[model samples]
Target chain A: MSSVCLSMEGGSAASTPAALPYYVAFSQLLGLTLVAMTGAWLGLYRGGIAWESDLQFNAHPLCMVIGLVFLQGDALLVYRVFRNEAKRTTKVLHGLLHVFALVIALVGLVAVFDYHRKKGYADLYSLHSWCGILVFGLYFVQWLVGFSFFLFPGAPFSLRSRYRPQHIFFGATIFLLSVGTALLGLKEALLFNLGDKYSAFEPEGVLANVLGLLLACFGGAVLYILTRADWKRPSQAEEQALSMDFKTLTEGDSPGSQ
Target chain B: MSSVCLSMEGGSAASTPAALPYYVAFSQLLGLTLVAMTGAWLGLYRGGIAWESDLQFNAHPLCMVIGLVFLQGDALLVYRVFRNEAKRTTKVLHGLLHVFALVIALVGLVAVFDYHRKKGYADLYSLHSWCGILVFGLYFVQWLVGFSFFLFPGAPFSLRSRYRPQHIFFGATIFLLSVGTALLGLKEALLFNLGDKYSAFEPEGVLANVLGLLLACFGGAVLYILTRADWKRPSQAEEQALSMDFKTLTEGDSPGSQ
Candidate 1:
């Protein structure tokens, strides 16, 4: 079952600007661009935002773009970007970033729900809401599971090793779902808020479309980084790391370190 | 740098149901399910498909869901599923699947534009249209480049090997974009057709929302398959496959074979 084309996987030239950093930087740029565009769409065209008012609904998109999409993307990048950092430090930073994302995302959820209830509008009826709520719920659950299994140190080394791939798979999948959900929300926003004007290429509509494209591009960049076998973190002394007792013997003090 | 945690990446045990087959089967099930759902949506709810009448627009979604989403996904899975097949046969099968996808997708594109022209509905104004068109355009270009580089047998071995990663990256990324655009189109379809009924959870709206979720799950499964390092196509042989004279000396007649 060994791969037949491992050597054909190309390598980056030493003299070239490192591919990983470039992609990481590009992802960050697109991330902030979409977040900023979402903010502008809310502030400039949507009458801005506030707590407990119609404007509060504006906070929802802005916060989602910021917290769920932007910050969440960065959190996933923690290990990749800080590859040389002590694994323990990277794990904490990773968890911390996710905490911030979850908190902010919670506020975004509240903003929409609060607005919906105040206006007597039904909640969770639209596809956008369904996708969004699923993403958020999955995000929370993923974090809880991730923390307990990977960060809390209670898991047996064998178990942790076993669960690692599933964790990464789900993490990557959920991040993608967040991106897809954000795009769904964009369509909902344009149609619900802009209406016929969205069809006429109104500035707000154009901005939102651009935002949607940017989000997909950001997601693609991240996925590209992730799937590039060359970009994966090195298996430092892979055999020892794989050894059943290595984690307990050498890293027991930091039992949960990645 | 090598990954510091390679051993922890985990592997499927021999006793388990072979995971690759399970994921590949699961992806196919989701792909066919969503394609069937799309057909049902268009035929039952959206008035059905034709060439030049108002019903022509129905062809757009149905063909796209089948050709672009389902067939294209299966095309991407060709390498992984046919791992032991003769490389020449697999390459031809891959290209042929894509050719079929392009033709079908082209018909779908024509259906939309023709319908728009007939109805005097402005085209490419909405985010859905913009995203959908972009995906189609890129799909064409990707197919062209992939054929010439990997199927036509004209490129140098070094060049083909180098471009392989980019090809794989773009292919995966474009597949994802196709899925994203479909979700956007679903939102537009629901809003444009269902309007207020969508908010009321009309059957059509609920059906489309389910389709959207299914599309996402299908995309995720394909992606999971794509990104699993364990699932990557093997190198046939390391030094030989990567050797500068690999094709010229050993397999020139099958120069484009994977």
Candidate 2:
């Protein structure tokens, strides 16, 4: 691991040491609070949850808010939060967290489909459903590509360098898409349940609005931390050094090596 | 302009000379296509727009999609698109495009509010409306702050540098928020107008869904251009050189100067 090399070379000097932990902690709090708020919205306002009744629909939102938005976001933050950990350790944890999020999200998806089937309602008809499927599909593909390229045995050195930027870009884009999809779902859910009361600032409507804002805020917070160049894992300087090595490696090698 | 200095110093060497144009062109086409699609959806399916009647509400989504999502996104791309242009020129154009977007978006806002008020319906109650207002409010603030810091004779160089990253971060976040809000609006609008037929795959619903996907695709394209480190203006090497200048400028001076 590059991090292993960094530690061996006394390259563990992380910048802004004092600020990052607070950021990580704040993100954790917001994520957790969002999950809890989603649960409360479904339980208190939408009736209690159960698999056999129409209330099973509640699990769709609860599980998605926790698994997709909250857990998935926290998984993305793992690399930065555990900046000093072994790169391999973080990579494995990253993959594992994604796995956990995906499985929970799968449960959420199944809950909705099973509920819809019992009621004989349409499936994957609304824009929310379409976008939801899109987000999940893309996230899965991204996870697979990331696992193959960066985790398992790893792609060739040059291949990894070329793909890293794209991997990061798609990861961030998929996260945004997931958040947007979740917001769409929230709006549809509120409208379906509250009907005209949604136009009158009903308690359920108000609660859902607050939840949407929290999700947006949580999303913004995570992206800010992720984009802050100086806060990059292994420090920015070491990152450049590593990339510079990448430059040299590519410049010296041929396509045959890959 | 830093770019003026760069030109004086022979530092105008943009990387990815051929690919950058295609990227910019593709982004422009996507943005234009998205705006046109919104226009078609409103015109054909929403029964055309008018100054009065419920039809006026059509302008809300149309203008928001055009101004907030498409135009605003293109505005953000100006810097990277014209990487070789004068920084001051590009900065003014950037501010102006934002102004243009805000004005068009204001027209959209007024249309919806006036429609709601005429119908005796509540305003800003729905999650879409709430998020829409938030996106617009943040965009206004972001534009104002960007103008004060980067234009209007500029902040102190040190202060400018300090705020630039935040400006860029918040700008991207707001853009994303606008896209999310647009998707929410599209979903609600389709549901409201198409009603139960939406679940039956109405043409309008499908059109709106396609439009939402285009918006997401456009956002991703613009952000990809924005985030690619190698595609940065003044070239990455020159950017580092400029930042190194800032480094000396900050380290050599007192905070009192700023």
Query: Taking the candidates in order, what DockQ does each have?
Result: 0.38, 0.37
Candidate 1 stretches with Cα past 4 Å from truth are A1-17, A237-258, B1-17, B237-258
**Which portions of model 2 show Cα errors greater than 4 Å?**
A1-12, A235-258, B1-16, B235-258
Which digits, one per residue and each the tens of the lDDT, describe model 2 over residues A99-218?
Answer: 999999999999999999999998888889989999999999999999887775525777777788798888888888888899999989888888888887788888889999999989
List TM-scores for all candidates, in order: 0.88, 0.88
lDDT of 1 by residue, B8-38 (tens): 2233312122688989989999998998999
The superposed Cα distance between candidate 2 and the true structure at residue B157, in angstroms, equals: 0.8
The CA lDDT of each predicted structure is 0.79, 0.81
lDDT of 1 by residue, A28-102 (tens): 889888878887878888888889577988888888888888888888887677755556667789999999999
Going through the candidates in the order shown, the clash numbers are: 14, 0
Which one wins on lDDT? 2
Model 2 agreement with the true structure over B79-184: per-residue lDDT tens digits:
7877755566677789999999999999999999999889998888988888988899999999988887766552577787788889999999999999999888
